[model samples]
Target chain A: MMKDEELVIEARDLTKVFLDFWGRPKVRAVNGIHLDVRRGEIFGLLGPNGSGKSTTIKMILGLLHPTSGQLSVLGQSPRAVSVKSRMGFMPEESYLYKYLTADEILNFYANLYGMTGSAKTERVNALIEQVGLSQARDRRVGEFSKGMARRIGLAQALLNDPDLILLDEPTSGLDPIACREVKDLLLALARQGKTILICSHHLADMQDICSRVAILLQGEVCATGSVQELLSTPDTLKLTLQAPSQTTLMAVLDLLERETGTRPQVDLTGRTLESVYIETVSKRKSAS
Target chain B: MSHYFGKSLTRISALAGLTVRDAARSRLLVSLGGILIIGLIGLPLLISGDNTLTRRLQVILNYTLSFAVTMLSIVTLWTACGGVSSEIQDRRLYLVLTKPVHRYELWLGKWLGIVALNALLLTLTGFIIGIMIWHTLFTSPESETGKRQACEQFLLARQSRLPESPISEKQAQASAAALVKSGRAPAGIDAAQVATELMKELKNARFVIAPTGTVHFTTLITTPLSGINDGLLNYKIESSRPERSPIPALWEIQAAGKKAIHLSVTNYPGLPNRLLIPGAVMKNAPSLTLSYHRLDSSSSATLFMAQNGQEPELLIPSGSWAMNLGRGLLMILCRLAFLSALGLTAGCLLSTPVAVFAAFFIMVLLAMSGYVESVATSGAFYIPHEGHELSKTWLDKVILSQFKGLNRLTQPLLRLDPVPLLEEGRRISWLLTTQAVAWLVGLYTAVTALIGMILFNRRELG
Candidate 1:
């Protein structure tokens, strides 16, 4: 929304070929991929397993070298240290040091950003609270549940207050509440003009947050556009309102048939399960 | 510049602290510590040698310290290898690497952390052994003979300087020539062999002094000695002819203008004799002169001072033992640093098991470097058939070349060993300690770390 949009990530024909011991190609994980993510946009990369979504994300994060072609993050090469300093990445799994406590992990990452003293302490504490891991701060990450570990992983990803964030399957293993919290966090980050690139298979989560998406299949982009433009059907329309009487419904169908030469499909509108669950939980919390 | 340096230091320190904390919480540290405690303290108690207390103590120092260093090396290697490879394998390294930290800092931090743990453990074990040595040598009740043995042998670090041999090279050459002319030489005798034989003959040569005769050594030492208040000489002697009993011999030792030490001994022909003289007598002495008189008119008295490496004189103490031990431990820390670099580098490029195995193989190769060097240098890889030499196979050439290259690589590290010096109670000089740091820790570790960093930078963390 805060756009005089500046490009944060630009790729042209990026490719990555994983090689075996003798330099024979084992898999072309990503091939001829092109991408552009701009500031203040939540961009999603959706794909099934082995579809090169993670590989592309890794290339953007500078964790993997592109086999060929040009790719840049923040107008610099993907391997540029300065570019990486302004970027944050959370891999698909909660890849965290098991022997470290949550507080320690956050502190460790904060220091990696050259922060120290009370500045570091405050930032670490803020992140731990932001990720809802304050109560588990002192517990070793090895002892944490999957959800707890994911929370800490998220906390570490934000330690540097990076301008660009890459989150791979960020909602995996998270509960619905936490999942909603993560979506809200991503939107909050985007509102601050922070560019986010998320790679996930959760279409609903992607729909709720991402403004634009690129769907990958077999290391190639099958579709890429704004979620609205891609999901909307120009030939169809839906009405969500209070259930109308038979007379009103018949009048609407007659008008549509006379104008379009066809009757529109009609069905009773129902609230999505996520919304109902959230509403019931909200109500229960207010009552409590 | 200072601000950037401070920030980098802070980051590196944080990573190192995390590494140390991780290792500290693991069961491996506790187990290694337990083993070290048992081995250092229990091994001394378990030994049942018939040797005297001093001999047993020397043996204990030699065995236990060597064992402790070997064990510490294994532990250090395992920690370094597993710490890096496991992080990478579990994808934990991705989190850290994604931060603003430089890749070199991560590897260096891990190495520093592992070395810090090694330092603490080694220092603790060293202190315990030191206390044990102190108790055995001084604190425990001992008889006069036992105390003398400890002082004259194990506890004191004596400096031995050889006095000039009375027999000349010309005389030794004449003797070797006479033996060869008498057809005593074997075929294909080289000049170097002849020289060696001549040196041996000189070492066995002895001089006899009749009544009122004197012998003088014109050039004994070129510099003044320290940490010594007196000189002790162990002499082996013989008589010209056998006697029914011991014969009375009178001797006087004089140096510079100082008063001579006079001694009257009932001399036995085949016995070890000790002579103690004031060190101050040797101060500013242009030469040392001795006079011997056969008090009883039986035969001439003979003195034999030749041995393999041992000399006639010993300077009782040259330096403090505590400083020596400190230097020894410093050398050990340098070696551990080298090993930490090795393990970390291997782990950077391989999986945990493979890295560990590779590091172990390297360690074994380094340990057997002397043997590898002999094989490589002696051209044992070459094949000889039908009384003619043939070139080595390509495979043999490759393996030998690899071993030779490794020898050149690890020789500096292996040469920094301090165990033998510690066991012998010889001072490991500060110069040697500095060399160990420069070559083993600074140079070798830096080169290895550079290679590892390059590989790690290009690595794809998939």
Candidate 2:
């Protein structure tokens, strides 16, 4: 039983070099690295631009092969069907067929997953509703707002009910409401035991949704851990006071330094611009 | 791959249906088709009566069909290119590639849709011609004549039996029969081309028409020659009317009571005046259709099997009795089959219009340049020297063999040309529709498969 069960993906010493005309290495897009993603988890891969994140993703997808290494998905070659059948990918940019309507695009993807006839139509309708695009299901994808396009991309990604979902910058260009919706959808999917690997630079966003995170920098992972484990510093606590004066702040700072052997910073301000904006909008919405 | 294939195919099929609906809604296809229809409607107006108009219309329609088919080929080839390049350039391919679709499926599905578009265009255009043809042949006042006209064009043919043997009496008779049957002679070869084309074309010789009209009352005999220097036989004729005699040799002709037309000879075949009739007057019931074509051998234009200098299909065939539909069908078959191969091959590699244009140029170069270059560079064993016959006739066999290889390449282009193929295809009878179709399909299969492999290999998704 153990022998029959295999790792979903395995990349050993995976490295890639972008070459110029003379066959000399122009840049090392991916340095030597190794990784294996489990069958199911909301695994978060966080990185800034040019951190080899997209490169790694492309290599895993077999769009770009590793320069020197053995890389396989679902215990077969990267090009093999076993992995492709189980896989769904969302790129940093979602370039859908402009001529196709939202419903058509969803239907097309569903068909690629071998869903057809009434089943295809039903699944497509459900996806449209789930993505909050039922209202504009017939709208041409070209006319959709960026958020809507992202939602459609998300819907297509989920069409196959793929065993492994790769979502890159899923909520990169969305309004807060849309962002929250996408996050919730991902969470809901994760709850259903689907393996999802999300790549994004939004640390706070990943922190909220990811059970585990790997932070990459300069073509390498600098840190990897759960949000609480990596972020919670020990022996650090301070009281929030309304309109604390400098003298009170100084006294508290001194007390905190003496007790905790560390100087503590004070902040009298509690609400950020976003908080005020949200509250004002909520109030206006309620009034209307 | 197959699942993705089926899915992608289904999507494209739907896309094709949507395209048809959208295209209809936009009135794009309808407008173009309307223009095509209107243009055909005016074609008959430009000609004089039923028979005349049918002949004119037949030429125009055949030519129009050919041109349209070629254009459609270009369109399909171009669309294939446009689909891929546009997707990548617009960054739209990311949409499908990201899905669970294989690259091959994506390629194949798109190809299917494009070909379907081609078939639509073809059917639409062909229907217009078909309607015009039916109206001209069936509903027109001279329906029987029109059908006979088309038949005559196909049956009557002119060709030389291999030229190395001097144009013999029997061969000359056969050629005369062929020429009269087709209403004209093949183009003649000048001294310059004789040496070159002689080896290349075993049967590629020019047939000449003698000047002046023929008189039924008297016998006129003359010998035609091969080489210009062999000898010249001069002759003259007394026609039934003196006015007819003063007319130019080309335009003048004598009826039954006229004297024997004077005979002349040249370096070609010989003919007896006993069978000579008024060349123009003998054309009873407009005998057949006629077409003029320029040949490499002669300075004057040679006549092809044209019915009254127009489409042979619109004239009398084999004594004006039965309609030989096989001829027209054969021509259409050659065009469709060859063009299919060309279009499909062009479609796969060149997936865009510009790329397809490049592919056409490449294909043309492959055919023409390969032919010319080989002939130009081949080892020269026989440079002509004066009076150097030396009995080295054995070289004929080897040189002819080499020439045949070159002709094989040229044969495809020739066969694709329906009019010529239907006439001369009898000589190359072994290569028929089935073989032609196989050749075409094979070309399409190989090229399309290559295209699929390339696209699939280049594609990547997680």
Candidate 3:
């Protein structure tokens, strides 16, 4: 368990009930739920559609008021202006001014963060290059492709160098290479002691980066723990070895059956389609 | 505190800048510019007016300037309605609200952006109109005297003084009561209603002079006439008869410390007349009394001076025309500022189309407030014919009360419209301009902004 001071996000009985025009309860989007995200760790909020993941994230970001709850972000109320200044949020969609260029958009956000002069320019430039949007920096976001717009959105979320970053569907429309880059970026940010809370449907990406995750079903948490603790099967034994001939494989299987009183299942470890696609694209670019 | 204010200002300015850029890059600015260009330049060319230089100038000022202001007002309301509501509808506000910006700052930033755009457009169009006015004055085919007449009558910023009525409302009411008791008025009619109608008749009776009869008017000039060589007495007369022929009349003019001057002249009916009063005669005068005497007993026509106090008035040169035009434009800009705030407030509570409709409804109601006041004051929706009793109903009373309330609320906006004054070349006094700013921008706009900010802060952007 993390100490109280080390907890970046703490919630108790967080609930959001959407109301109709007459102020009657229409939908219970988020039920009484509790969450705790510690410092320097990537926490994932996994849920299917209408399962309150987005609502929870929105409440944490102070975008929506909880019906009845105690929630604190970075040891302060989420709606506090100072707290917001110390945090960053990337919504599910880009939600940018369509007419503004990427450079202009970043500068606008930087200004909102009270940055100015040469430092603002330098940071904006570096982020543009980091997002691989240097060539498209002058183009308006309205003209950008979905993947390119997503990259710009990510860059803006990191513009303030916030201590706690909340991203919703960070890699929804990204290509495999961009997805890998984003995952790598999240790891690097965690290494630098920045807390991240992500809400996404991509379980593979969540499993790859999240130290701990909570699975929500119909506005309530169904399961939560570390990836290893939740995924490990206590009765199963797994091992990997170098490539072996068919006779060698059969000898190994027979020895396992003799030792364990059952024949062990065997399978080949294969590369993920995402990794293969990235490798192929990289190799093709190199050859060109 | 100063540092905090500085940072807040910086954020607001960035948001404001974004709004301006959005307008510039979108089709709004271009469309407005195109409309203004065509209206300002094409309108004067298309409309036909009298060949007199003064008449033509009046037409240009009245039509083209009015057109520009009307177009700008509609566009300003539309743009302001869409500016914030569209962003909210499209969910762009999600990203903005997540930042450290106070909701008030965001609301104020949008208002300032729309106001700034209006200022730019007003200034540009005003400049173009000024150039056109001057170009017409110098290049018209009229003679030099005609041009000089136009400059004096239509181009100079003059102050008008109307004669004060000698009769009071109390006197009218007492007389109305006597008539009602005497059964001369319709039964069941209120004395107050009778008094209002009686007052109009009494005032109108003062301007009508039977043949061989005389009528007098006294005008007090508050501002001293200095350096001006002449002042004008502008009047229009109509006869009870339909004859368009001229009638012979004698005018007796009296000023302080000066002898009464009398002149006999033939005045045409249904035409405007200007009588020049020398500066020497009016140099130190505090007031002037003029008496009109019908000279012909054989003529049976009863001369009726146009009432409403505007006719039979004195015009004294007060300021330069250019300065007056500038003040007029400033007043228009103040109105635009108020409209922007109103539109923003509506947008805060409604979607774009509904907001636009609500704002426009409000503007139209304000514009028609004069008629509303009349109807409310009369306590009837339609004018009752003479000798007709005004029947009362509870619903009528309730509706009239509502109309009165609306009129009271909107009276300040209509009290000092600059367009008519500009058309008549009357001075839009600095005091009037200051009051406009205070009432429209400071009072109305600030109130609307406060309501809008409160709503915006409480609104959920999720």
DockQ of each: 0.71, 0.36, 0.74
Q: Using alpha carbons, what is the TM-score of model 2?
A: 0.67
| Per-residue lDDT over B296-369 for candidate 2, one digit per residue giving the tens place of the 0 to 100 score | 23223222111111211111112111122243344344444334334444443434566667656644643464
Off by over 4 Å in 1: A1-3, A254-263, B137-139, B148-152, B158-316, B373-411
lDDT of 2 at A43: 79
Per-residue lDDT tens digits for candidate 1, residues A78-191, read 777678778888877878878889988888888888898899899988898899888989999999998888888888888888889999889999978789999999999999
Residue by residue across B196-233, what tens digits does model 1's lDDT show? 77776655653444544433333364556541445555
lDDT of 3: 0.87
iRMS per model in Å: 1.3, 4.2, 1.0
Q: Fraction of true contacts kept, per model?
A: 0.82, 0.44, 0.81
Sort the predicted structures by lDDT, highest score first.
3, 1, 2
Better of 1 and 3 by DockQ: 3
Cα lDDT tens digits for candidate 2, A221-283: 677776777777786544655776779878877987898787777555567664576677779
Candidate number with greatest TM-score: 3
- Sort the predicted structures by TM-score, highest score first: 3, 1, 2
Residues A1-288, model 3: lDDT tens digits = 445349899989988899999999999998989889999999999989999998888888787888998999989988788888878888788799989999999999999887889999999999999999999999999999989999999998998898999999899899889998999999999998889999998999999999999999999989988888889989886898898999998998899899989889888899988878988999999999
Candidate of highest DockQ: 3
lDDT of each: 0.78, 0.55, 0.87
